[model samples]
Target: MKLTKTLTSLLLAGTMMLPGAAMAETTLNFVSWQVGEKGYGDWWNAVIAEFEATHPDVKIDFTLVPRDGYTDAMITQFAAGAPPDIVHLTSFEYQTFADNGWLEDLGPWIEKSGMDLDGWAGQGACVWKGTTNCIMLLYFGYIMAYNEQLLEEGGVAVPTTWDEYLAAARATTFDRDGDGIKDVYGTGVHLATANSSYTNDVLIYVLSAGGRWTNKDGQVTINTPETIEGINRWRTIVEEELTPMGMVGGDIDQLFMEGKVALRIQGPWINGFVQRAEPGIKEHLKYAASPLQPPLGGSSNVITLASETPQEKKELAWEFIQLATSQKFQELYSELGASPAPRPGAVNEAAFAAVPHMQLLIDATNAASAAGVDRIPTGLEAQNNEFAKVAAEEFQRMLIEKLPTEETAAAIQAEAEMLQ
Candidate 1:
């Protein structure tokens, strides 16, 4: 009888320890498009490792989806009641997910957690319907990146105004070799169909011309005279062959890095590519504010509202979000040369001290208009995406087929009005 009681007691003790051990460990699923990219991937992995070190029981299961289908993938997963614990949301997708009731309202949590929002540069982009749904990770704005050596060789000064920009383009666009073909181009015009670059590139001109696609009342106003002038300016560039033909945003950046293009409008992230490609090339690369208004671009992180997630997992996921937006990670973001951190003080001063030119790019972030808000009203992601597709198609016709700008603008306005 004594031996039997002892064995039973020992078994019960072991059983009790099992639940305790299970309670100590948690695994969270984090989904983002940055997992495999160069600077972004490195920064994310480093932060994850640090978070795991402090919270020994938590494991982050990172899932990387390509940018092309990231939104659709998350939506599908959420519909099936198996969404990732954390989601990376772009400005265009934020309102759609929030309006669909697929994202957690993080206002109360942020208040409870004491996450400061005042210093973030693009904080306005993450709030919807008076609820804070996401937090800004990085704030990217459009800027002019030029090859200093090319400008110098062509005796062209960096353009400060629209007329100057056009003059510089004409001056620098010439055949370096007498091969009867132009070996270099002055700039690039992104006219690809069904792409955000087309919309953003157009926005730079539209906003610069004091024309906006939509007004404060959420109305579509694409056919205004200012907008017409903007489109005409872009058409002139195409007609004059100042920029390379059949090039998109990516092509512009690549050509700029290869020293084939004299100037291009790109985000701060391009500096990282320039630094990595050829260290000495940094001396030749320079950045300036766009000749007109700068378009805002970047993404935020949010927690998803999917079924079957344990409360502990939710808490752990929230902790990860807090850590990500913390000053330490923000500084890491700057140190890695990803983009300017959303928070004001997070741009690692020491790192920028070494590369002073980056401070100018960071300063340019102040000039950025709110990403989707400046272009369209809140809660119009689906409409905006559709409109972007139609607009890109029409704009391509204008650029490639030599269609009249007025005709193209009217067609674009018709499609946009359908959305309204």
Candidate 2:
């Protein structure tokens, strides 16, 4: 009797274990630059946790590749024919992957699932080569972060026009304590970093000056009168020493957080750093609308599945994506990410009361979408990285060599046209 009971208990235990073992069979890998980041990381984790709960058998293995190296790392994976199950790409870089067929097209899946994608912010950015290759999940606009105390001391208000902005920068940029050395810089821009970031920041001026990197026809327009005016404005700021020389974005951001820099323009993500700023400085930091018209912002990032992801795994990944795009998560994005969520009507006014600047961010996003602005040059989307480098080099030349703005513009124009 004892032996029979023992065998029966063992069988029950094994049966119980078998179900759980079977349930935990699937593992999906997700890679992104935002993993472990302040707001974006939390949102990603919450969505993944709920997704695993809903689909008991699946686990998401999250990895963080720093933004500076993300493009190369992802390219290496796809080249090896074993990319991550979940692929997250930045706005200007996804087209290269789509062109190479490394991304899974979701048209048939969307049809089968009957997902409603109408009026989705940045939805049009996902359409590549007549197919939906990814979801543009993080379209955003740039905002100006300014030091309230510094502006008060300088006797200036938040600027609402480019000329006013220049005047404000001039007032705040000065040598503190009567020292010959410059102490407080007026603005922070990515000058030495020489990447898409520089392009993005400078283009804010270019667009505001009534110029574009390229026209709708995909020809270089940097040498035009309006464009040169904008380029000269950037030259004026740097030449006048309103901003520090030879600093990358990271250094500049650190300086801004430390209260050494008075004003800076960046995407909504800057809010996260603002919250973590030093106690005395954080309270005085405020956000405002940029003087730049049609802010240099749109389609910041996208999420897609790898073409090499197995069919069953792809189905599971798609479910995870569905959760990410659902209304609940969309609301979470607005609250947690502190930026305008891509979904229409996702932002909560009450939730955004703590960060009053978000109202302007929303307005900026709407204006940019209506203006049809993009960070990457129109015809050079695939070669965006190269274009950025070229522009940065010429910009640095104009700053370092004190080359004439018109000459620098012509150089950028000639080099950019060669990319074709």
Strongest candidate by TM-score: 2
Candidate 2 residue lDDT tens string, 167-285: 99999988888879888988977776678888777888888899999987898899999999988787788888889877877678778888888888888888877877989999999
Q: TM-score, each model?
A: 0.84, 0.91
Candidate 2 weakest ten by summed lDDT: 16-25
Pairs with backbone N, CA or C atoms under 3 Å apart (clashes), candidate 2 = none
Q: lDDT at 81 for candidate 1?
A: 80
Q: Residue 329 in candidate 2 has what lDDT? A: 93
Each candidate: what lDDT?
A: 0.72, 0.84
**Each candidate's root-mean-square deviation in Å?**
5.5, 5.1
